[model samples]
Target: MHLMSALLISLLLVSGCKSTTTRTGPIAVGPGVTQSQSPSPEAKRYTYNSDIYLDVAIPVFNPGFPIDDDTGHVDYQELDELDIWPQLRRAEAKRFAVETKQALAKTKAFGSVSVVPNANTSADLYVLGTILHSDSEFIRLEVTVVDSSGEPIDTEDFEHQVSESFFRDAMNQDKDPYEPVFVEVADYVYELLTDMSEQQKQQLKNTTLVRYAHYYAPDAFAGYLSQQLESKRGTQFYKYELNAMPAENDPMLQRIEVLRNQDMLFVDRLQDHFAVFQHTTNGPYRKWQRETLPEAVRAREARSERNTKAVIGALGFIAALALGNNSTSTSTAVAKTAGALGSAWLLKDAYQANENLRVASAVIDEMGQGLDLTLSPQVMEFNEQEVELTGTAAEQYEQWKAHLRKMYQLESSAN
Candidate 1:
């Protein structure tokens, strides 16, 4: 009978060890066994005879923190003015975009991969992405591909959990742990391009050039560059007609080409500013990750310990009740002691979990302050016009495009 009671206690304790706490709120790490490296799928690659320029737009930062149901979209303006945290998030998004561009460029999938400030920038393809969440242990992104006309081509969502081994490799290499995520994104884009029909590829090439010309000299190409739809019984139908293309040697087209080359020079110069921003933020960003990783690990372990103790306490109580009538006074006393000891462990676990969470939060807050020190307004000048390049690449591009339009108009009028 004593042996049976001992076995039962051992079984209960073993079962208790298997259970874990379900984390709630922002403290939750995604469910998975950490992989040393992600599996590489054999991706198909296509070689295009003609050049294809791809523009990667600066990603939007979406803080995945839950808010009240009554609160719709987050007012970023309010947050931007008041919160340093949001500013850090914005910096994270910019860094993410730059890394993605670099990844795409490395793939050699396109003739050129440029990090355009906005969607309005002309390219054969546009990659728009949003940073849903970013932290030391995990990163999530949603990406969409569209043409110059805002027509959706493809969309994909990606999430990656940074394993301890992977993190260590990244630290040793002096690289971002999330670099694999960007590589996957580039692969997805490459796959999409490879699967396109020849006709679709031609359409993409023509549309990109037409849009570039139209932006600078819309009046010259209006009739040749308009979207039209086919109608059946006075209703529009599936059939659509794209703009007609001008001769390759049209004088206005040739002029637009020269103008675009000059515009690209300006765009290339703008990249230096982005390079500076990246250099300024990269150190603090990586330092924050390296410093916070241990805290995250400790917090996870604390939660696990708390859960184990709670389960053991509950099981001990059950065992004590089951053995109450059959057991000797000595056995009863031992069972009671086990239950009491389990309860004490539960209290200790709770305290440790709370302390771990507090420490993790403090570490993140300190990192945010370090990032704030690196923040500064960036401005660039072109043709006597000063443009603020402090916001997302898209915002800065919009300002640059406006300046280009004015310059082009002035030159056209002068001629």
Candidate 2:
């Protein structure tokens, strides 16, 4: 009886038959985890030397959508079957890029920060961002920076684990829970810019301008810039040099500058469109994030507890089976009986935990349905000519660039 009582008590505790509080344990640290890192990031604003201020261009980010196993593309039927949305991910890629642009702009540490529809824009600096994984509970991004000379400046992966508490605070509701990640990226970029010499900035600016000029008249402007393939930090980029300066009064140069200014103005309008998309998506997206985060946490906890209970229960049954079959004493029989009954209870509790996990997951699925599930076409115009920019954002951007090239060819032929 004494042995039975002790065994029963331990099994009850392991199965969580009485306690309602969730168990906590040590978290596994990642390979990149470093101790004593900068604590809790905040986006700070500062004005730096005007000479080092360089034009920045950010393209819409890669969505990193999961592909269908058979089709090799995102299949809406598969998404519906799994209750997942890749369309939201496509939209999120743009929103994340725009948000980072805003963070950099807030710092006032750089010049002319703008988000272009695509990567065709030539600028003194380019910030490319890719989304790896994003959810209400966590997000991961890979950011790369490059100069106009196509020289890789820096790259880093930033990740954040968000909790329901981040949204629970009343004052923080209107703010991004993931601001720290963006702020950290902006800080690092500003730090890099601070280290650049004025000469380097001017060279990068000129290189970009010349490259843009080459788009219009390659024969005339391409000779002014020279490029050599070089490897830095295990990445290859073309290092550009100014072979010679184009005459200041060159007719082609002046016309190219005018065309470039017009392109920038168009990009500014596109940037505003991106801003509006983020604003409209934000309210509903944040609400869903806040509502579903706790459920996600709960589902994880339930799985953990279920696994723990399953292992313990399996052991309890094995021990009881052995005691019953191998023992000849009556007291051992009593203990065996108790163990068998306790094991049954333990397995039942484990099953309950699994059910809890499913319920929580279902709740998240419903909440996810709140956001509209697709990106849309956009209208773009230049020189009083308008076209419907169709397909993915990247495809649409290529269409716009092609239109620009056609326009340039017409002008050049006439001249």
Candidate 3:
């Protein structure tokens, strides 16, 4: 009996233990979470005897929204309840992208790291990202890096969690709280590109024009690129490779390059879109995080303590039942009654803890409601005629590319 009782106590102790430093529990929407930093060692920039350095393009990330599979979109009330909205998510998509570009630029592993508006931008390398989760104290990203050859360099998840003190120090140090995570991502990319031979990189650059030309004129560029089937761990995938390179001074090739340069110029101009979004959203986002810090801390602490109390209460009731079954003494009866009452009280306290959680959530919800992120449209100049770029940023870029395709087809036919 004593051994059995000892085992129960040990189980309670083990189950009730909590870590104050970090947490990886599933984050419920509308609830506050925890945080910590992950600092990655910065490596020296990779250099080769050759002067060519691969240009990198990073498109805005895919902002995560819990979409309803049936409708293919999210509900507005659900957004409010989740403490997030479409505007915030869209802004964050660009926000994380520019921050990552900044981090990658500091590494100097590539010639230039640009936050391109087009996901299919003609660059030697692409670092694409998806936002899995982000909040006041934590963030997770699903990143995929590929070269023009369509070879996957790295496809992995990166996450970070931080505490209140981390935010306090971020202001003092004049750094963004999310900067460390982006820096870590950049370092990982630099290390991988270092292992790639210069010839391999040049190959990626070589295909840039072919890929861009194909985008504009698929039938004309056909047979210039081929796909190879690959199998790994019983999974099949395809990687693209250039079959032939057009002559540098070929009239048609020169025309395609001219079109590609025009497209690239348009893309370079869109950097201002990302830059403005970062500047506008940074202040409100940080302010929201700091304002909700207290509520988050209280909610987490309450949840931890509630779990511990519930566990102790369950163990007490079991022990009391065991003792009461063997004894009919007046003292034993009183002891059982008191043990049951204690358990009930603990249960009540657990309910109260949940109420505290609700209060914290409400506080965060109010803060979320008050957060308004303003957006500005981009102005684009084409043939000395300046026009306001309409539609979503992504939509505007896609429309511009479509217009470019028309121009290419008309010119090609005339030639």
Candidate 4:
């Protein structure tokens, strides 16, 4: 009778224990897909030889939110006060800028393609982008092109969904998940540049060259090539204006070109640091996601199990006490045995839940430390003036432009 009672108690305890089995679904492979068709022979024949220097600025991460009826605006507040999601979104914006630069270079439409920290950097043309949405499944960007004077030349919206094949390719590390979107953006830019008239191309080149001259020797070129005001119709339009042209072979212009190249070299060095920043953050970020996501899910499951076991254990103890007070001695003994076993299992589960919590805390701490180590302030210098490059490129450019205007005013007054 004692042996049977013991066996029954053991069975009850075993039945109460939570299952540890975890089910992971099978991996799904996508069907193969072909690349887009190439351009026609006639289309391929069109090419330009203009020494156009292009600059791509880091995109703004614009999180969408409904403002009013049928209207939406970017939740800049969310990005400014960042959490993990916002941090990831910011990183995606940087990646988009880098990819755009790479794509532009591949097209060979420009003499050189460079990624600048802000729009204030001098170039024949600039590509600015804002990331409307970006995730593992899809990305959307609003891209615009402008000359050195900030005159809008072209604008387009790019939206791409990650197809099954593209996702599979990214999973296999065969290609970047965002490469398709970058390619489309590049193709559009190429088309825009190719479609431009010779007069437009020459005008952009002249604007860029004149801006350089004005930057280095404002006294000599400021009156001839003013970027202050223009008149269109009856209204005065504020823009970069060229009232007179400089000789193509002027010695002063050649000297300015050399100085500009030296500045570009300095900017290139800064870009190298940005590359390091990207590398350090990207690797640790991926590792953190891989380690913590599954652990978080498992932790929740463990807590659920712990709750179940505690409730069952408490019920058993109450029933055992009742039986002991009113039933036969044998029944009382069996009930006590069952209650003790249940209590023991409950204690074990509680310990496991606590352990999971500790592990989760450690993972978070480690991720925080990694982010702290990698994140640093990026400072850029132009004309020996240091400016901390933060916030949107457009914002930075405005600040820089304001500073330039003040300096010019001060110099003009002194003269």
Q: Point to the candidate with the largest lDDT.
A: 2
lDDT of 1 by residue, 1-415 (tens): 9999999999999888877655564543468745435465675454655454444444333444333356786665554332226656767766777788777777676765666555556677778887666657678888877655546667789998777665565435577788789889988887787777767877777777777888788788877666655444343433223468989989778877776775676567656656777788888888877777676666567667767776776776676666775677886878777776776677677667767766675676568664422324556565576766555445555666677677778878888
Weakest ten-residue segment in model 2 by summed lDDT: 366-375
Per-residue lDDT over 344-386 for candidate 3, one digit per residue giving the tens place of the 0 to 100 score: 8887888888788778877766655433324356665544545
Residue 325 lDDT (model 2)? 88
Error of 1 at 379 (Å): 9.4
- List the candidate 2 regions with Cα displacement exceeding 4 Å: 1-43, 66-84, 227-242, 310-354, 370-396
- What TM-score does structure 4 among the candidates reach? 0.53
User: Candidate 1: where are CA atoms >4 Å away?
Assistant: 1-84, 165-173, 226-241, 300-352, 370-396
TM per prediction: 0.66, 0.74, 0.77, 0.53
Ranking by TM-score: 3, 2, 1, 4
* Sort order, lDDT high to low: 2, 3, 1, 4
Backbone Cα, N, C clashes tallied per candidate: 3, 0, 5, 0
Provide the overall lDDT of each model, using Cα atoms, as 2-decimal numbers. 0.67, 0.79, 0.75, 0.62
Cα RMSD to the true fold for all candidates: 12.6, 11.4, 12.1, 15.4
Worst 10 residues of 4 by lDDT: 58-67
Q: What lDDT score is found at residue 126 in candidate 1?
A: 74
Give residue 265's lDDT in candidate 2 (0 to 100). 66
- Considering lDDT, which of the candidate structures 1 and 2 is the better prediction for this target? 2
Instruction: Write model 4 residue lDDT over 142-199, tens digit each, in one string.
Output: 8877666656666789887654444233343434556678888888887878777777
Score residue 165 of candidate 3 by CA lDDT: 85
